[model samples]
Target: MTGSPVTTENVDPLAGVRAPGDPACDVYLTGTVFLDIIFTGLDSAPVRGTESWARGMGSSPGGVANMATALARLGLRTSLAAAFGDDKYGEYCWETLERGEGIDLSLSRTVPGWHSPVTVSMAYEGERTMVSHGHEAPVSEALPGPPPARSCVASLRAGAPQEWIAAAARAGSRVFADTGWDDTGAWDLAALPDLAHCEAFLPNAAEAMRYTRTDNPRAAARALTEIVPLAVVTMGAEGAYAADGRTGETAEVPAILVEALDTTGAGDVFVAGFVTGTLAGWPLGDRLALAGLTAALSVQEFGGSLSAPGWDEVAAWWRRVRDLTPADGRLAASLDRYGFLSGLLPEPAHPWPRRRAVPTLGFRALP
Candidate 1:
């Protein structure tokens, strides 16, 4: 069944806006959960009717799983509201996300006799193509109660449940909505009105341009500011463009340079970082830069959820460059760009516990 259309009278995203206050959980993510089988390091896609070889292969939970794991690793208390089948894949995802990543899944459900979603991701350098299949439990069945979070992450798609966004907004939860690829290319403007309840509307460059009917990412982001308070257009490799209607300002951040092996789940990781920074009260530029850095770090490793860097990794990277004395001007400028990380990292005197790589990896680092 289709959800009720969003109207201006019903949604005032700013009406609920207040100073950041303590909440039971940091983020509440609602979406599909897919068991992903990722193949990494392919020189190129397979020819039609031919096979291609991959240097590495790994399995991890996909979809919202990527964002959940990323948020947990960044030290956010995240809760997921989604459906999982009562199958082994579903069990694997549950245990991995909850036990391995420290994400709370109490709101998520395990449906009986339903097949969980699964996807096969083909990774080629910084790009990926995926073939997915599965059954998604209705949103009503997945999250029957009001959201218990300070913020929420949802997807903008056809037939999405608009009521959830409305409920979150009514409860003073900041809503962040991300768009997916629309194969129909309709770029449905009808979806824009639904974002009235969202504090931030995030979409990739192509989606932003197509949705706003603009010629470029900047123009698209500016156009989107008319509908939502903050509009972020993520331009892969080119970084992201952000326009804040509340501030009447626009900022663009360049992407971090890294050796990308697989781009699977990079977008989700970026969202995680962006949301984390937003809740932390950072400036828009710092948020975009951190998001870009998070995405860059994710591409450096294999797997989807498994590849997300934890606080330890981020701190380690910051420690490696904090005292660098670059000899060249351009190198110095590049290092200066990352100076924000130094402030964001945890205190050197107090080490935060790291998430386990897997259930059997053991939690402690070797002495």
Candidate 2:
């Protein structure tokens, strides 16, 4: 809320190729949204029986909202389908997505008498511990079908198949999926039946290795391509490696070095970046670079959804890196790697509203 007047004038990454009759939305997704309360500036995790005080705190919509906000801020026309509780928290989340981020929530509905899901996250020593509480919304509240869009991002859970994924694929929406950790410890790929329709699968190094039974992340990425057309394995500090099954192309990009403050939803931000690049049809290496850069930026801030950077932030980061004097080999290499962004970034104008995590939700009325 502390920036220039919030404006929706963002550079459309896909402007040059857009044709008439194209889907109005660039991405479509559906999942639960949680009210995330984050506590930062902690030196270490709290001990039992001790009253701990965090130096900073912030609140924002989380869960699926994290990915939704990231996509919208990147100038993708994002549409979300999810259930909201008829409560103050729900109202705040709804308004933030629709008005603050310009996300289309027409497919979302509110359930009467239901309280919103909430998560309390404590970030310390570059990691986070979270405790969440909420009951599952009734299945009857699920979206009837996926809307036509250029692409859809989905979280694939083992043993639970989302029917809309196949329907969306059949309707010509490219599907990109990421899986949650299998608490059952099975890590069986067959459990994710919806993956058969996905155009790409993105997973962390451990998840990729466990699912493919490979000792190396790159090997896991290769093995994963047997199932999906594209496989991206995020190697954390090492960056990401991608394998395109159809074209037999492979690319690896190193992660950007940044002093991370909180990593609440950095993975979701990474996926949003990849989705933007994929829909815009960038090269595989450029897609991986953009994804890593966006995630690197998100960790420097607090909360999940609000910490997401808009095109302005991306442009600013590009300019900052390009201006460094006496550049070393590493800096020069980075400049060369990200040079593709020069043509895509919008010219600097009134910076897009750069939202940050604030301690309180209540603001005094302006005179």
Worst 10 residues of 1 by lDDT: 7-16
Kindly list the per-residue Cα lDDT of model 2 for residues 221-259, writing each as its tens digit: 999999999999999999999999999999999999888
Q: Which regions of candidate 1 deviate over 4 angstroms?
A: 1-21, 48-51, 138-142, 328-331, 346-367
Compare the candidates by lDDT and give the number of the best one: 2
Residues 1-367 of candidate 1 have per-residue lDDT tens digits of 9976433112212222334556768788777889888887789887899888877778888888988898887777788887887898898888888887788888888888788898988888577889999865754564665456888988877545567778888888899989788877678867455687899988999988988888999999999898889999998878899999998988899887778877777888889889988887778988897788778778887767977876566665556555456753333455666776654455332232233223221235679
Worst 10 residues of 2 by lDDT: 346-355
- Give the C-alpha lDDT of model 2: 0.90
Estimate TM-scores for all models: 0.85, 0.95
RMSD of each: 9.1, 3.5
CA lDDT of 295 in candidate 2? 95
